[model samples]
Target: MTIVVAYADTPPGHAAVTAAVAESRGGEAVVIVPAVRDERVPDVAELEGRWPELAGRVEVERGDLGDPSDTVIQVSQRLDARLVVLGLRARTPVGKLVFGSTAQRILLDATCPVLAVKPSVAGP
Candidate 1:
């Protein structure tokens, strides 16, 4: 089965792709680019360039500029993916309450198992 990845162009997004590559273990990765404020999405060329190891097997799907949580959940269910991989960053309790989290929604709603990972920190 293919592994579904929630991809973006930020640090967390890059981290998610890396984590997905490691988890795929030579399997295919269905990368979904959830819409951002700018409407910029990552094409195959970008994804391949950023992740050479997963070049051929990476399939990118662009979502509409809407609720990211909905896109992720829908795609995961439709693909019947083995797992849904996403990058997670730490957030304060107040921040979470103020602005609802897409990651939290995905974790609670995805049909397949969700794998949330944080980027590794560099030593000072």
Candidate 2:
């Protein structure tokens, strides 16, 4: 089974990748789909360099879709992924109301299970 990740270049995005790796059962492929509009997709080599566990098993899939949320859903469905992992960042109520949320849409629209994670906070 494949694990699809909604990737961004942020703390939350890194956390999502970490969570996906942890959730993997050794043989499952981890496919990353950029989840932020206009954000560049990370090279597979770069990703493997950062997360050694993902070496040979990680790939980037830039679907032929426009919206980030739509692309995520489309890739997950196309791959029939076992899971979809994504990260969450805190947003003000006003900000959420105004901008809406891609994460929220993916969580609701994905046909498979979705794993949502937040960055680990450092303690004082």
Candidate 3:
């Protein structure tokens, strides 16, 4: 089964990739990162450093797709993915009322199942 991860240079995106990889143990996990237009986004170094840990499980694709949420689902569809995974940031009621969450948008539009991962931590 093919699983797709939507990655941005954000904590949520990082966690999304991690969750994607974990769930894709016996499947293919593809990471989709948008290419910057004029300004560049930092490269995902973890993709290389963690190669040994991922090896055949992960594949990276770069594209300057116009719509991030749409692009993510499109890539998943193109790959015939069984799942599309993305991280979600908890938003306040006001925030959600003003602007919907990416995960919510994706969940509503994705053709396949979508996994919304939220980071849960304790202590400091």
**Top candidate (lDDT):** 2
lDDT of 3 at 11: 70
lDDT of each: 0.77, 0.96, 0.68
Ranking by lDDT: 2, 1, 3
Please provide, for model 1 over 7-53, each residue's C-alpha lDDT reduced to its tens digit, 9 standing for 90 to 100: 66677877888888888866566565562434456787877887788
- Ranked by TM-score from best down, the candidates are 2, 1, 3
- What TM-score against the true fold does each predicted structure earn? 0.89, 0.98, 0.77
The number of residue pairs in model 1 that clash at the backbone is: 0
Instruction: Judging by TM-score, tell me the better candidate of 2 and 3.
Output: 2
Task: Write down the RMSD of candidate 2 (Cα, Å).
Answer: 0.6
Candidate number with the higher lDDT (2 or 3): 2
lDDT tens per residue, model 2, 13-108: 999999999999977999999999889988999999999999999999998888999999999999999999999999999998999999999999
How well does candidate 1 match the true structure, expressed as C-alpha RMSD? 1.8
The segments of candidate 2 whose C-alpha lies over 4 angstroms from its true place after superposition are none
Looking at candidate 1, what is the lDDT of residue 89?
Answer: 82
Global Cα lDDT for candidate 3: 0.68
Candidate 3 TM-score, true structure as reference: 0.77
